[model samples]
Target: MRDLEAGLVDAATGHAIVATDADGVVVVFSRGAEILLGYPCDEVLGSHVARLFDEAELGSVLAAGDLDTDAPARREWTLRGRDGVPVPAEVVVTRRPGVGGVPAGHLFVATDLTERRQAEQLQDELIGKLGHDLRSPLTSVLGYAQLLDDDTLTDEQRGYVNAIERNGRRLLHLINELQTGTGRSRSAWRGRRIRRR
Candidate 1:
């Protein structure tokens, strides 16, 4: 008797994994896939993945191609979970290439964005609140500096006001850019050339 290594990889590292054949039949379904999609590997392994994504056009851009050129189409699409709940998830398809650089099959690697999306929404709210909070102090500082810069004030006071204005401008720039999307690698985002840190 031959022993086949069965039943999932590390759940921590292996959350939601699905495999498909040339005909797009789910061949290897892991425990992680079950937890994420609510479908057992045994029940889903032979089924078409499109059934989960077809209603929402999840397989529209999908085709058998090399990973470098095709494979992962990083886009926001709705996926149908086992309970018929529509999940907003990001689908990443990794393609396998065989010998002679030909396309073989596809391996899908999915990271659930449900929680991440919620976090992003919360972050947006915090940023807005922080920006508004900072604006109040900034406005006060600007007003005080402007009053000092008036002809009624001395030369040294005018210089200090100018410095304050410059620092205020710098703070505004800091809030807008570096703190934003620079935190994540733009693997799915297009156009902008990434500068390596």
Candidate 2:
């Protein structure tokens, strides 16, 4: 049974697992924890788990009585690494039961959020760039359409110009919303009617 538990913890390379005794003394530090925290098991074992957290963060958790419950508690935490770097993570902590159903220790499983945050930021940048690139040419098209609305044109030609300007304004409005991350409804645009000059 011990061997199976060890194997499971060792195999989880994507999630850091740290087990502590009821008093918060480090008992098990998985390989994933070592890689994420830059701490060797030799140095971390028998040490207080509080050392891995910022003082204020640890204090908040303790004050919140998160450890007093049997149900797993999850929260976002910024753990201090061996090199003093901060690692943002989503952490789930559960109480480990011992003999006679008494709480023997706690198990912490943490998933690193650094890569996810970076990817989201990059996506926002790309979207902003695409919106800017599209708006420039669209502005030119709208300007030419406006200039074409002169009295020299036939009635049908003027109607075509009106359609172009209306659709162009709608498209521009959508692009502006996208750039601002407002995510306004598309149905709102459908009901709007742009007046012709």
Candidate 3:
């Protein structure tokens, strides 16, 4: 069983795995942990597992409750790299059961969240740019529609102009909602004019 666990840990390349004794002393540091944390196994093996975690975060977790529970605990944490940079990670800590169901040790597995966070930030920026691009043209359309509501037109012409104005205002309101993440009334835009640039 120990050999099987070691084999699995060695094969894992994408997640950092650190196994510690019940007293929190590091015992097994996987290759993935070395790459993720910038620390070789020899330097980390005899140290306390807390050295790999951000101090404040570790303090908070310790204050919250014991980590040797039967159920695995998962949370987002900031790990301290050997170079002293903070590495965002999703961590899962599972207790290793011993004789009579007591905890012998704990296994800490962490997955890096840096790339996922960067991708999300890029997505938000693109959405904001798209909203700005859409709004500029929409403002012009609404302004032109408002200008066409003059008194020199037949009933049919007036009806067509009114339809254009109404639909344009609705579309603009929808765009504003998308950008701001809140519903706003079209009356908020009443009497607003676009300046030529």
Give lDDT per model, in order.
0.65, 0.89, 0.85
Model 2, span 1-197: residue lDDT tens: 99999999989989999999989999999999999999999999999999888789989999989988999999999999999999999999999998999899999999999998798788678768988898999999999999999999999999999989988888888778867767765335445665644
The model with the greatest lDDT is 2
- lDDT (Cα, tens digit) per residue for candidate 1, span 37-136: 7886677878887876646365346443323464365656676789988766776777656678775666776667789888877877776677777877
Q: Candidate 1 regions off by >4 Å? A: 1-13, 54-57, 63-78, 86-92, 95-104, 173-197
Clash pairs, model 3 backbone: none
Global lDDT of model 1: 0.65
Q: Candidate 3 lDDT (Cα, whole model)?
A: 0.85
The Cα error of candidate 1 at residue 111, in Å, is: 2.3
The candidate with the higher lDDT, 2 or 3, is 2
- Model 3 earns a TM-score of 0.78
Please, what is the TM-score per model? 0.68, 0.78, 0.78
Residue pairs in collision within model 2: none
Model 1 root mean square deviation, Cα atoms: 6.8
Model 2 sits at a Cα RMSD from the real structure of 5.5
